[model samples]
Every structure is written in structure tokens, then in C-alpha cells.
Target: MATARHARPKELENASLEEIMDRYVARYADRRADWAAFEDAKIEGYKRAQHRFIGAGGSGKHNDVSAIPAGNFTLSIMYVPPGQGNAAHTHEVEEVFFVLQGHLDVFVQDEDGRKISKRLGPWECISCPAGVIHGYDNNSLEPVYFQVMLGRGKPETMGYADDDLYKRRDEHLKAVS
Candidate 1:
């Protein structure tokens, strides 16, 4: 006896944004419908802490999530502990930062190595261009909550000069400690 062959369903073949969003929401709802699994995920998300200690430079903590490819952006949620800062660094791509809390002093170096600095407070945002040497210092007594979005570029491609070392090791140590 010959077996009957069944036809396969076609793919979405270009769904609209509304359709995609509706499907995504429905999928999340289904995943969250499982009480135990949802709760476990929430707990795990809260418990996974990541920190980078200061060596010759500075230290801070970060909580990063795998980024989506929708807008060619990488998003990170980071917390700079009070009195901690990053070593002078720069990136080869444009980046945007939104300060959700606390204050930060950003020092930037231009093409000729001339340094310029500015202070950022809560709700402040800055757009940093590519190839500019830059780094941040936490000037507040509390941890700063911030989100950073980077464009597609190897951050290491930007040139850096460790001019901030003197600021950290010499002038700021007594003040910070």
C-alpha cells in the first residue's frame, strides 16, 4: 500500500512589525505562564554579579545581556561603584550613554592628545564619537546606574593614552580613600 504524503507549511515569508511583536509577546506570555521556571529565571538574573577589579587603573561592575540585532547596537547596564573609575580608554565606534543615577566626570582626549572633561549627573546623556580617547571617573558617593549603547566597532581599535593614571594614583587617591 502506498503511503499518503503530506504537504509542509510555508515559512512566514516577511511578517509585518505588528505581527512580529504580537507573536513575541505571546511567546513571552507562554514562557512566563510557567510559574516555577519564570521565578527561577528572575532569581538567577538577580544573583549573577560580574565585577572587574582595579589593578593599575580602576574597577567597576557590569550586568550585560546579549544584544539584539535590530538596530546594530549593543546595550549594557553597568554600575560604577563609588570612588571607582575606568582607566583612560577609547573606542573606534560611536557610543551613547545614559546616566540613570549619580554623577560621573568624563575626561576626553582629542586627536592631538589635548584633554577635555565634563561632569554628568542623573538623567544626562552623552554621544561620544569614534576615535576620541576617553574614560570616566565616579565623583559621587554612591554607585552610578547607567546604560551604554555601542555601535558596531572593535572598541580596542581606538587609541588610548593612560593620562588618567596620575589622576587616579596621585591626586585622587587621598580624596577617594
Candidate 2:
């Protein structure tokens, strides 16, 4: 059921390696944001948060894209300072991350609900299956930047496990200690 589109616009077209690189360079030329914006959607939710994702580029600043719908897929650029990273969360869809710069220490839940941590370097990629509880922690001295792509449906739900993170604070302390 995975059919690729044939005639996408040159800008949005999924192209070969060289062509994609060309498009990226051209797109980056006139763009002025410290980081890149990939996609966004407007919706009426319980908390009313704008659904926007950015492409990997800067240290802390990001240019989020919200003008277009992700259409079953979401892409975002995640940047974490030396010691800062995202909290544990899970989505209804699978996600794939490509490391663009620096290194990232990713933490995810195992079958027995244990945390599995892995350090990935540039050009490496990681995948989080749907319904998996996972998050990333930046333990490197330098900032870590990566691009995240997730599958999305028309009605998508994003769930965070912040409470679970706190609940596992004892495990966290043990890891850091």
C-alpha cells in the first residue's frame, strides 16, 4: 500500500540523491530562518497547540512549517543543547530520525519496560515503531541536531509520557548517578 507519487513539484518532489541535494541547497538559499520549517497544521484541540515541525539547521532557533498539512507524515528538526533533550513520549505512528550533526544519545523502552540507551553519530538513523515509548537525551558536550520524520493520518494523536518520566525518576537518577 506504499505508492510513491510520480509528478510532485520540483521543490517538493522526491528525487534522486543529487536532485534532492540540489533542491535542499536551493531551498536553503533564500530561506532566512536560523533553522528550517518542514510542515504544520491548524486544529482545534483541548490545548490548542499549533502542529508545526522544523528541519534541522541551527543551535536553538527553528523555523517551523505550519502552512501545509503533513498528510500522514510529520517531519521535524530536533535540536538539544549539551544537557537538554526531549521528554519521553509516543505517537500513534512510527518515526524515523536522521542525525544531521553532532551526536545524540537516544533512550527508549525495552520489552520489559527497561530503558535502552544508544549513542548515534552523524549520518546515522534511528527508527521508533508505533506505540513505543521513547525519548532522546543529549549527553554530549556539543549540541545535537537531527531530523525526525513520522507517519501521520488525517486524525493524528500525539501523547506524551512526561508523567512516566517523573515516575521513572529513580531509574534516571540511577543512570546519572
lDDT of each: 0.47, 0.52
For candidate 2, the 10 contiguous residues with the lowest summed lDDT are: 39-48
Instruction: Assess the local accuracy of residue 25 in candidate 2 as a C-alpha lDDT between 0 and 100.
Output: 40
Give the runs in model 2 whose Cα sits over 4 Å from its true position: 1-68, 110-113, 153-157, 164-177
Residue 54, candidate 2: alpha-carbon lDDT = 31
Residue range 1-177, candidate 1, lDDT tens digits: 965386322433466668555543322112211111111112222111112111111111111111222233444445666665554556667766678888877777765778788889889988778766776767668777666666751122223354433333333222223
Cα displacement (Å) at residue 170, model 2: 26
- Show model 1 residue runs off by greater than 4 Å: 1-71, 111-113, 153-177
Best by lDDT: 2
User: Evaluated with TM-score, which candidate comes out highest?
Assistant: 2
lDDT (Cα, tens digit) per residue for candidate 2, span 16-108: 768555434423334343221111111111111112343321111122332133345655556556765655567666777688889888778
What lDDT is reached at residue 108 by model 2? Answer: 87
